[model samples]
Structure formats: structure tokens, C-alpha cells
Target: MRLPCILVLFLGCGSPDQVQPEIKQLNEIPLNIRDKTEVDERTATVNDTLPEGWVDVKSLIPELVLDIRYATSDNFVGIQLYPCERCLLRKEVAEAIAVAFEALRADNLGLKLFDCYRPRSVQEALWRKVPDARYVTNPAKGSMHNRGAAVDLTLIDQNGHEIDMGTEYDFFGEKAYHTFTKLPAEVLTARRKLRDLMQEVGFKHIRTEWWHYSYQIKNYEVSDFRWPCPGQAL
Candidate 1:
């Protein structure tokens, strides 16, 4: 459902109070979108704002595939954030990414945006799908994604095919670990370039998931907001 922005003071580190109660109680949250009417109503609640430089996937970039549900849906078991249709990000980040992609494109490289501006419900959906402490975070707390400052991305070739990253997005295995040093040189270089540019532009990379990054620093808080804003009327 479309929600108002929940105003939260930025905490350097969250308190014990923010710690999720327990995985056992997590089932209290709904996990599936089985009812079409309910799903439609909930989807309507999502604030589909197209931030500057953010393109509507259906119109501007339909060729890109959204494979997020593989992990959360019955059709797929892979853990990944599904693609968002009308979500957006800062124009500056988009420009920087376009420039970086230019460098790749000259050599026949392309960029694939897996997610941006995720609704909190979507985040909670993921939390319920895989509550294992090893990978997914508990929605009872928070996610960088809820802040609208992070993104999960990977590379695509000129032909629109995904480039090999040694492991899939959200793959909780050793291969998906950024510190794993056994990958090929090209894969490492690609990851490094992505990390460098994102860091340069104010995004922080998560160690466990290479594709994920966030602009959670102090200044960029202007862009950081909670999805389904709890306080505001929709």
C-alpha cells in the first residue's frame, strides 16, 4: 500500500531495542501475495515516485530483466532483490553509473540495475522468504534498501546478457563473498570498478553482497527515506 515517509533519526548504530525479536515470531508477518485484490491494494500503496534520472522500467528500460523473486517466490529459489518498475535513484548516481558504463561499453560492456527505491513491504517480503541469519536481514529491524540509498547491480554485455560474477546476487555461499579471492581477474576488476565509482559518489558497499551499495552517509540523508512512510497519510 502507498505509505507516507516514516521519519527516523539517523542512528550511528542501532540500539538493542531495534534488534529483531526472533525468527520464530517472524511468521506473524505475511509472506505471499496470493490474493489478487489484496495484492492490488497493497501494490497501490507503494509510492511509485520516479526520482530525477530514474527511468520507468516498463517504458525506458524494458529489456532489463527483473529476477528478484526467484528467491522469494515459488518459481525460483535464488536469493535476490527483484527489479522495480517505477522506482528511482539520485540523478548524480545515475550519471556516474552511465559514465562508468561508457567505459565498459567501449569494450562491449553493459550495466544491469537489479533494484532501487525498494518499498518496505518488498523488503519485508524478502525477510520472510529467507530469515536465515547468514544472508537476509530481518524486516522487524531495517535494511539499507528501506533508506533508498542502496542498490544491487551487476554487469551485462553489449548483447544484453548478464556477465559472470562467479555467483548469483544474494548467493549466500562462499563464492558470493566479496573477500573470496579465488575469482578470475576480470570478475574482480569489474567488482572493483563498481565499488570504486559507487564509493566515489557516496555509496557504501556491503561486504557480503558485492552488488549492494548504499548512500547512507550524513549528507545524503536527504535522499534516504523509509518506504510506505508510516506517519504520513497516503
Candidate 2:
């Protein structure tokens, strides 16, 4: 969904109270991800570092709050699919996210990333579990994420709490739609805040997921490799 989101009305969600919590962590994966070394020999990326033209978002924004869901059992698959929690985006995309995050900082806000730069092998694993193209992108055709051009993220406040956007991240269905307006004004405002900032930085939103964005300005080839986990052998 890297294409620019259709223009949304922003409502100065600078105040956390504006995006009040409707359902606390509903369908949300609690943030408990920690560093680990548990690569699946069958699917782990065989590389020792990020591939060329790729950069870990943390390198650009050390304070990046990465809740890489697939790295833990909290995701839809209910399994730890990644050996470690990392946010690898193409260099340009990573830069764009950094710029967006810095822009939000003036408002005392931040972006919490959920997913980024998924490996093709990981995409296949997701496809294996949820073959529905409507939910999981077909590994055959490839997702923009598979090409390191997409990200799943949400907005956060100064205290590092998620700004309620009505539903939680990765919650599929009608309520997740970008146009699903049957929501509190603040929630709509919060969603618009995220869309506007991301779009300003050249990211696009999908109609169904407020947290998903793509880096359509530039494209990269799909990769089967993963970033090597710390303490994992070469």
C-alpha cells in the first residue's frame, strides 16, 4: 500500500486524550519482544547483515519502537516466524520513515513500527498459514513488503503509548478500512494524523489497513534472505 493515501482530514491528534482508548489493546499484540537467537534452518535468512541498499531503521532512529509481530508468537500465525526483531527497510524508505518520525516529534508524537522488509521465505510461510490473498499477499505474486518497500506501523504518544485508532494493528475486516467512518471523531482524527504524516513522507495506505504503508517511490527486488540474528552463526 505504498501508493499515496487518498487525502485525509487531519485533526491535530497532538493530544493523546484526543485519541482516547476505546478498547485497550484490542486485537493488539502486547509489546514484549526481546532479542533472541532462534532461526529456523528452513527459513532463516543466510546472510550476516542487511543486504546492499538496505538499512535497519534503528540505525537511522535509535529510539525506534519496533514491535515486529512476526518475530514473536503474538502475531496472527501464533508462532515466532523471525529469529530476531528487526526493522529493515530499503535505504530510501528507512530515510522517509525517519523524516516522518522527526516531523511528528515536534508534536511530541512518534511512530511505532510493527513490520517491515519481510523476506520472501517468510511471506511463503505466511501464505502457507493464510493462503487467502485478501489477507496474506500471495508469495507467488509478492507483496510490496517482500520487496522491502512496505511497512506496518502506528502512532504513539510521548510516553510511548499507542494512539487508539479504533481497532488494533492487523485487525482485518470492515472496521479496519481507511474509510470506515463509523468511529469516534478522535479515532478518525488519530488515523488521519498517521495517514497524513506518512503520506507526506511518500508512503501510501491500503484501504483495509491503517497501519500498512508502501514505499512506491522506489522499488526493489524480492529477497529470500533475512537479517541475521545477533549471536547466530554465519
What would the TM-scores of all predictions be?
A: 0.57, 0.79
Model 1: lowest-lDDT 10 consecutive positions: 1-10
Candidate 2 per-residue lDDT, tens place, 1-234, comes to: 222223223432222223322221211322221122432221134322666777777765667899999999999989998889988888778777877777777799988999998989999999998897667899999999998899999999999999999998888787988768889988888888787676666676777787888875677888877677766542
Q: On residues 1-234, what C-alpha lDDT tens digit does candidate 1 reach at each position?
A: 111112111221112133222211112323232235754444333324433333333222224444443324422244444432333454444334434444454577666776665656665766777786556656665665554556678877777787778787767777776666589987876676665555544456666777877653333333333323234432
Top TM-score prediction, candidate number: 2
Clashing pairs in 1: 1-42, 1-45, 2-45, 2-46, 4-229, 5-229, 68-82, 70-76
- Model 2: residue 97 alpha-carbon error in angstroms: 0.4
Whole-model Cα lDDT of every candidate shown, in order? 0.51, 0.74
RMSD in Å for all candidates: 15.4, 10.8
